[model samples]
Target chain A: MTAVPDPTAELPVAIAARPAPGLGALFLTCLKIGLLSFGGGLSGWLYQEFVARNRWISDEDFASSLAISQMLPGANVVNLVICMGDELRGLAGSVACVLGFLVGPFFAVIALSALFDSLPDVTMLEAASNGVAYAALGLLLVICLKGVQRATKFPPGLVVIAAVAIAVGLLKLPLIPLVLVIAPVSVALAWRRS
Target chain B: MRDDDLVTLIAVFVPFSLLSIGGGSAIIAGIQHESVAVHGWISSREFIDLFAISRAAPGPGTMLATLIGWKVAGWWGALAASLALFLPSSLLCYGVIKVSNAHKAKRWHKAMREGLAPVGVGLVIAGVISIFRLSGGGLVAAAIAVASAAILTWMPRFPTLGILVLGAATTSALYSLGD
Candidate 1:
């Protein structure tokens, strides 16, 4: 594809030396992602905002953060926002992001149940929800495939990817034990090669 | 919310919060076990509905905690449960990020990054598989997934919200036509 001119390029260097996103910006962005992302694509939405759109972090940085978030405990997306937020504005940013992200969804879920209860048995609601869910899966598939594409460039990386997919996806092993078994070995192998 | 109910919420969610390595999906079965069977806080049917609503709503699947809390003790239950589920892991994530940022040039950091990348990829693919299964075996769902993915991959600029809306509309139309 032809190179699109970056809009930031037009700005004077002195003026362009902007600060990192403040807590408010982080909060709003997280809130937007939280409210808009309908189905199971919270991570994908996060990637879009932080990496793709805002250019807050490099793709590799985002990927590493993502890896760490997934490997650690809690909701993957919530952990992601925390990592990103902390990077941007320390503890306060982390707090803001989680609060902004969850605040909307908190009320939305409650409202949704109430709405469903109040409605006169709309037949199409479930169908639409399923579609949205599938589409969200599609969003996830796009990101996952891209991750695979990036990983497969190295043979060892490809092997690791395959091993994890089978162990977690197919075998359906308990994650904590699986990670305990796999993570250290993978890190050690990478350590040796490096 | 009753004082004891909040205590029970904290008791059940805190350990699961820490034990939820590889994200909240890992602890879902445990939550179900505690809520539906052990605690009798919500019935099995309500659990399923809340799960669906959580998926369809936004944010994390763990927001099922919020819904459960709402059912048990109104809005305060939602807040309490949400905090119990999210706060501990987030604190852990905050510490990890700080360490990683501080030691940018460390060899072990590099190793961790490299090793974790493929693992993350695998976990995401595993997520795709799980969502597919949860969606049930449907040709339409499969097709929407493939089509949306293709659009995202090739165009790279298509609005995700548009795709979601389109998917919902198409699926709604199709299902509404049946029976």
Candidate 2:
């Protein structure tokens, strides 16, 4: 008779092999997220849909993926496609996710542009549009606050750098010069810590 | 849309897509340079109006390409230009992510993130400063920024859409009354 097997080693494989949602389902879900997200809620909405509502990845995994994406050199949404793709289906999965992400937003923007000329220039509509802009600013501010909170938990040196960068770079000095100074300092600090 | 216009559309969008970092707003100066200054696609006033529409509508601010495209060459131009604008960034992002994941635990990956933190902060700060400059140092503009920031922090419950609408309405009304 065979000895009883341990369950721990089987867990990751099981999670990995767990059947993915159907392609149609995945596409629809992504499209829905793309369509409904408004006034800068896309990132948070994505987090909710992918991590909270769906169980494709663990919370820690999702957070790390998000952080990595933010660090990368593209729009956060596209970066998300890469993260989700890797987690779900490797290279092929990444392509599919990226395609889905791009197609929906592209078509939606086209549709909106088509309607641009016909959109009423009335007072109420104008008012509503203005309101949306301010709301967008507020949404962006909230996102920045979250970023700050996350950064604060890192080394105190980082917090100091961020503060100085904001006060001196944002308020006083020009951008190009400020970046030239801060970039080297930040790199040096990271090198020392490492 | 003329074929030549399609070529111009691609020319404008390809570089813009590559350089439009931080967010869509960060690329506004570039857009202004292209549309208002270089190609003369639209007047400055019209550019401002388009900017308003892009922000007012839902979805990414990069969607401004569609409207500008539409203005340049009609529906087909809009479609072609929008695709060109987004495709490069999306493809580049996908490739980067793929490679990064392959060696995620490496020191270079960690260093990249550590290095980027300051850069990201700098870019955002630059964007905020740029917007401040565009507000022309007017008291009303300064008040709007401060008040908006305060309200957002203190009453986080209020929907952002609502705030934007109120500000726009107040501005429009004031403008209408010859302020």
Chain B TM-score for all candidates, comma-separated: 0.87, 0.65
Global fold similarity of model 1 (TM-score): 0.87
- Judged by DockQ cut-offs, is candidate 2 incorrect, acceptable, medium or high? incorrect
lDDT of 2 at A193: 67
The true-versus-predicted C-alpha distance at residue B50 of model 1, in Å, is 2.2
Q: Write candidate 2's Cα lDDT for A77-111 as tens digits.
A: 66766677766777677766666655666666656
Q: How much is B137 displaced in model 2, in angstroms?
A: 15
B1-179, model 1: which lDDT tens digit per residue? 69899888888888988988877767889999999999999999989888878877877888898888888888888888988998888888888788787886898988887777677777778778877887794788889989998987666677888889988998888876875
Report RMSD (Å) for each prediction in the order shown: 4.2, 9.2
Relative to the true structure, candidate 2 reaches a TM of 0.64
lDDT of 2 by residue, B64-103 (tens): 7877887888878878778777778767777777676688
Which candidate has the top score in TM-score? 1
Tell me the whole-model lDDT of each prediction, alpha carbons only: 0.80, 0.59
Which stretches of model 1 miss by more than 4 angstroms?
A: A1-19, A188-194
Q: In model 1, how many backbone clashes occur?
A: 0
